[model samples]
Target chain A: MSLAAFLTPESHSTCRPVGASVLGQRLESPADIADITRRVWQDSMNVLQAPHIYSGVEMALWDLLGKRYEEPVYRLLGYDKAFAKQPYVVVPFAAVPEQTFERMRHIRQAGYRAVKTGWSGFGHGNIASDLSQLAAAREGLGADARLFIDAARIWGCDVVAAKRYCPLFDQFSIEWVEEPFDPTALNAYADFAAHHGRMRLAAGENIHSIQQAQQLLNIAGIGVIQIDCGRVGGIGAAKEIAQYADLRCARYINHTYTSHLALSASLQAYAGLERQDLCEYPMDPTSLSWSICREHLLVGGDGEVTIPNAPGLGITISLDDLQRYVVDLEIRIGRTTLYRTPSIR
Target chain B: MSLAAFLTPESHSTCRPVGASVLGQRLESPADIADITRRVWQDSMNVLQAPHIYSGVEMALWDLLGKRYEEPVYRLLGYDKAFAKQPYVVVPFAAVPEQTFERMRHIRQAGYRAVKTGWSGFGHGNIASDLSQLAAAREGLGADARLFIDAARIWGCDVVAAKRYCPLFDQFSIEWVEEPFDPTALNAYADFAAHHGRMRLAAGENIHSIQQAQQLLNIAGIGVIQIDCGRVGGIGAAKEIAQYADLRCARYINHTYTSHLALSASLQAYAGLERQDLCEYPMDPTSLSWSICREHLLVGGDGEVTIPNAPGLGITISLDDLQRYVVDLEIRIGRTTLYRTPSIR
Candidate 1:
């Protein structure tokens, strides 16, 4: 079953934290964000598969806190000014070189300075064409723009193939490879880094906490640490990781593939970084960045979007938007809306 | 606010493990259980806090697997007969000596050979009276029977008071002191264990994983390891911990203070242990054990319980019992039910 289905709007209130000390206070402190999210984390940790639901709640918290402090969420995280807000467009891979080139061209034309493409047909068949497609995209984006490739890690790329193709893409000036292999394969990463000096490896989205981030950043090859606030507990955890990542000299990037709500949180978190690199933006036209709170997340002619300076994550939800976009239907099994045996204690 | 409230019967299906490979297969192998619980553990590791709800689902899994194999759940874990089925009655402390003696007398008369009392009046005012009460409990149980003291660690006992009184109880042949200090205070436990040679320090239920269990068991002072199936992920995780505890030469006991559903799982797991020790049984009349599934969980005249040999945890739930015991009213909210805006992704 989909997690999105169970994280119903009605259920959000049940997961919200309760404490008298913070009851009347503003949600500005990183501790406040952690306190709120950790409650939900502890309550749902054994049941929820991916923290996707908690991720949404964490985004809401950042928005609330940003609004409460009359600053963007990132500024609450100690950003004196907006950090580098230039994001790389995460473009899905195409089967052919023309489709890949077309996507890269669209990204460049859209004023995006960088583009990341997925490995659509990497190992299925015709490895040469896939490498050619990467070359075509790099050539299309031109030498001035940045290019990154995502292996999706779960697909299990062959070490031999990664060795062969990494250098091939390095010739195309691919800045770094995102999850070129499994993140859990630490030895594989060390081996890859030892062999492929030309291509840097980046990963952090799957790393769950400050501890996990520290461990991953310490790995020899991973140069970029991509942190998702939701996955790492909350904004506080992400900021702590960002600080740790900077101390270790790793480039910090925020992973926001969800709605503008989460993107706002990511942007805020990235603002707290000492050495901010590039954050991920889902450039897919179908993404909620365009349809839900589209105006705030829009890109400018300078190949970067400004951080929303409005209170909270700088976005507001209207009931009309909820009515138009959200699917609301009562899901009932018999007469019981909430079905479970009452607690004995 | 209670986990049992959230882990309703309807939601059990959502958290239960799935996958075609283990769908029809019997759950006999430790590896199979590890695979199943690990999937849930990984899914909920960062988001969900305490795994209490997931622990219930784990119990259900053990029950299902037990039934499928036509062997007692313990037998599936490699046991021939019931593991030390005799349990210690977790007797709450009474303010007066008569109350303590009377309770211990009832425990002995009821065929329970072992009794554990709480550290109620120990640190509060008079330490002598509390020691006298424990001595009274000892005299009431007649010396051959086992006696344990639960400090309830969360109550925050003073170190000076514990140091003063632990030796006094030891003089009365108190078998072990349960959580004399904080579960997290490894140094305190080690120091106490070094000084107090009379009573062994016991702990386990609060621990959440095999790693934590290993760390706690390695402490020089702790002598008994209490494994709670729910607190430690599930039966597989608890079993792994039990094996580790045995290797360390610590006595193994199952911690079950909840419903009979969880107790059966704990008992089954305890049956797999090589050094089977006395398990905990809440003898309070108000407990769900009396009202929920009273007959299935009844202790025999020998103060021992036989593992449910029936398919799946051996105990079956009746809708009539649920109707009588469960709360059926909807928990009302002052505001709109669906407060949070829907997710954009």
Candidate 2:
């Protein structure tokens, strides 16, 4: 796993943006094979087919792979040698395990260092009925809160007993156990990511492409490369699948689902492949957290998320902020829109 | 294409929840998979990585193959011999090509039929790059406005004259020319769908599965098959992908984008395959045409739509009729239902 050459001469550099994924929006847009087969068979016979989701052509191929790589999509894929900033948790199940462990001890004592667990109705049965509601909210939040578990597996249930419920995900300290199955169960979570590589497992965000993340990292391979960085094609296509999943030694995370201009464009695709991993913060205030980023979501007060040192994910748009969410998402105002298409002529 | 007879009728009958996509709130029904993966990663990651877009997980596998074949998802598949009724075209695009061709020649002189056109942009490019605005809206709408040209694609531009711009889509007679391009140019539209399959040469609605309709029916292969029927997972997953694209012969259309309860769940999955096809009807009023159901999309006076015999997309929701678009998305709702480390049985 080596390839990090250097020694160049700089001019006016800095290129970050391909943060959306699942095959870079059918590869930077090329329709008209008779109008993309008449809107792909009129949306396969009339709308309602978002099975897994993420669209704007993987956010314009993660803004054309962060302006074709000058670097930032998680340090061109190394998750920044692991740890620049990653801490999430907003489980919200309409309350009750002592109010979800006092909102995970006030989002980890207001630093939101990390959190997630809210699958209600996958309830009434196993994970010991969601381990007695997080063991009665960890006996009512005694120490700090840092946990994770996401069973959604495309809304279908009975997660094949997530490995005899791995001692109930090692008694709720579950830092991994996501997507309980779907995306072809990646060889049954690669035999549950080789018997819990120290409890880390996590799944790919409903994988869209990079050959379905090289077929779920050649089945059952993920010690923690959750990636999503905005559904796989936006911090320049998650810095080309976090630089080809940082040549396999795996470990990256960015799945923050939109606003904070997609969380500083997924902290600039994990500010170069992961600083510490964890960015799923919706801070739960609703109309779907205010129709998600209808204003480009930006929370602070040291719960973290500084990163936005500028260039792209410092996000700058004011066509009345694109006419307040989808006024037909148009842009073209000025700044001589540099290079044009046909794969950069 | 003859794998029918397989009933094995025993005893299976418990299908209720008539209509629901819900998520309106209580912390947005507990942030359903992070608010449906952040309100569908911008058009679900460009309609699931385009290869002429066919993400058909069998339209939710035919809502589970017409509730395991009680039959309705296009009569379980065979699309009920392709057309008893599915004509839709509601594209007003923000109107004005002489009031959108006099409302598409008054919905084809009020019999209420097939129609789709209304994508302009003008200011700099597209109305199919202006041949005097597609010959003054085809000499001010006479041809029953069967137009269908809309230009919702241009991926910012530099499209190196996509097939020398097909003489203004052959002067707006255009019965098909929807997204124009963006799911990574499926081999430059399979070389323009093998240089135009007899002109009407259509497309799917930015497809999302069935291996992207079997790789655009094994390259440039399309006559028409458009499927979407609710994010490819609802009307039992587009009738298990129109029975696996009817052994690659291909045919289906439904992508009209929501509420006629998802076009009456795409007319019971095209009433079991092929209804000749045209079910889109989106004409516009708003809020999915006035708060989702009771009725507003309107096209009657005989213009088509009939379909609602009542059962699955036949509609029935009442939490006091969705308690005025519900709410509780949570700015704060903690009593800490914490499930800290445990040993439940």
- Please report, as a residue range, the 10-residue window in candidate 2 chain A with the lowest summed lDDT: A1-10
lDDT tens digits by residue: candidate 2, B1-345? 000001111111111111111123222121232243333332232233211111222233334334443444444334443244546565543344556556555666655445565444532345344655555555545655566664444422223444455666665666666545444244445566566552354555655544555445554455565676554444444555665666555555677554555666665665644433456665544553235467433555555556653323344333344455542211111332111212222
Fraction of true contacts retained by every candidate, in order, equals: 0.02, 0.00
DockQ scores for all the models shown?
A: 0.08, 0.01
Query: Residue A239 in candidate 2 has what lDDT?
Result: 55
DockQ, candidate 1, comes to 0.08
Where model 1 places Cα greater than 4 Å from the true spot, the runs are: A1-69, A91-225, A231-233, A299-302, A329-345, B1-62, B77-82, B85-228, B231-233, B236-255, B276-285, B294-306, B327-345
lDDT of 1 by residue, B102-163 (tens): 88888889888888787664555477777778778988888899888877563232455567
